[model samples]
Target: MVIRDTHSLQLVWSSRISEDSTFGLRWTHSIHRSLVEEKYRIHDGQIILTEMSFHDYGIGMENELAPGEKLDIQDGQFHIRNMNRHFPALHLFIGQVRAGHTLLFSGTEIPLGSLHAPGAAITIQVEKRSILNEIGGY
Candidate 1:
């Protein structure tokens, strides 16, 4: 749920923004999420939250992030806004949120920071909701 914008990996959610849409015309593909992930599996319609951490020089590195600050979820063609929407949102547990979109390299760090750049270690809090629509499970 918690991921970085990851320029190397671009997951886009295709949606048509109305010219008069509340979200606005400039927002159709204008959405740029710090987190973009796809192809996830839920166990019995549930997600597990676990504590993640990191240590450098045998010491832990820590950073703080607020809710909906820098996170995004994107399917191959669907981008969830800042950990909001029906999708999952990952809360930062021990990392900092870069004000700008982070570029992750192949050697990016996963725990203590990306091999390429600083990465995100999150405290996952999963909530179960109706993933299906009243009309039908799209």
Candidate 2:
């Protein structure tokens, strides 16, 4: 995943560990630079990133989705809202996500993820926002 806003930016690489687990590396650019490595697990329908290591930046952080928090991953499309201490707010939209393919609707047709299976690889591009609170109204 690559998140780029006017105030912050992030680059992420993730690998599936199991049916509901993943390991990731994220680099954030803001007032300073930060490199974070983390593990994520799905619990009660929410994905939580834990066991994180933040290098270069002077803060420790974690990212998660609460149990009731929802992701609109229905009908092969989705809007992803991400918040983290290491970077600015981000919003991502995928036109399709399923086994063997992933498509982004933000006008970039860059192919990401494995062509052979689901969860093999994933990539996301965060749309930049002009205002901090304007989220494109998913």
Candidate 3:
């Protein structure tokens, strides 16, 4: 299948890193994202990538851990080291590796409900929004 007019949207993940353990340690949640470049396709399978910028943001907090200080994250928690097993890996469209054929964005999986079509072309428009405009600044 030939892809036309492909435009890449750079995504920055604001994922939460959690620590869980059988011990009595309180659960802590911190935000961090892998410095990765995310390119989205309009028709990646059953899901269509719309210009839905509102649905594109992940809300989380900033990380405040001292360097070399390890967090006590037990098994089955949302840590950066264990995130790969819990979420889908980043998608690529080159070489032996190809973009995932599922509805996923920024390591999160989206559900596909009866929108699977074959041989369809989809278009997505990206709107530019400055930080000033987002914060009600003129």
Least lDDT summed over 10 consecutive residues: which range in candidate 1? Answer: 21-30
Highest TM-score against the true fold, candidate = 2
Worst 10 residues of 2 by lDDT: 93-102
TM-score of each: 0.18, 0.29, 0.18
lDDT of 3 at 8: 35
Per-candidate Cα lDDT values, in order, are 0.27, 0.33, 0.25
- The residue-by-residue lDDT of candidate 2 on 4-116, one tens digit each, is 32223333322222334333433342333443334344433344544344434333332345454333343332323332223222233221332212332233332333222
Candidate 1, residue 10: CA error in Å? Answer: 18
Off by over 4 Å in 1: 1-41, 50-53, 56-138
The list of candidate 3 runs beyond 4 A from truth reads: 1-100, 111-116, 127-138
How many backbone clashes does every candidate have? Answer: 13, 0, 0
Q: How well is each residue in 41-117 modelled by candidate 1, as lDDT tens digits?
A: 22332332222212111222123434652422233332323322222433332334432322222223233233224
Taking every candidate in turn, the Cα RMSD to the unseen true structure, in Å, is: 17.3, 16.1, 17.1
Candidate 3 C-alpha lDDT tens digits along 45-74 = 222211111111245421433343233333
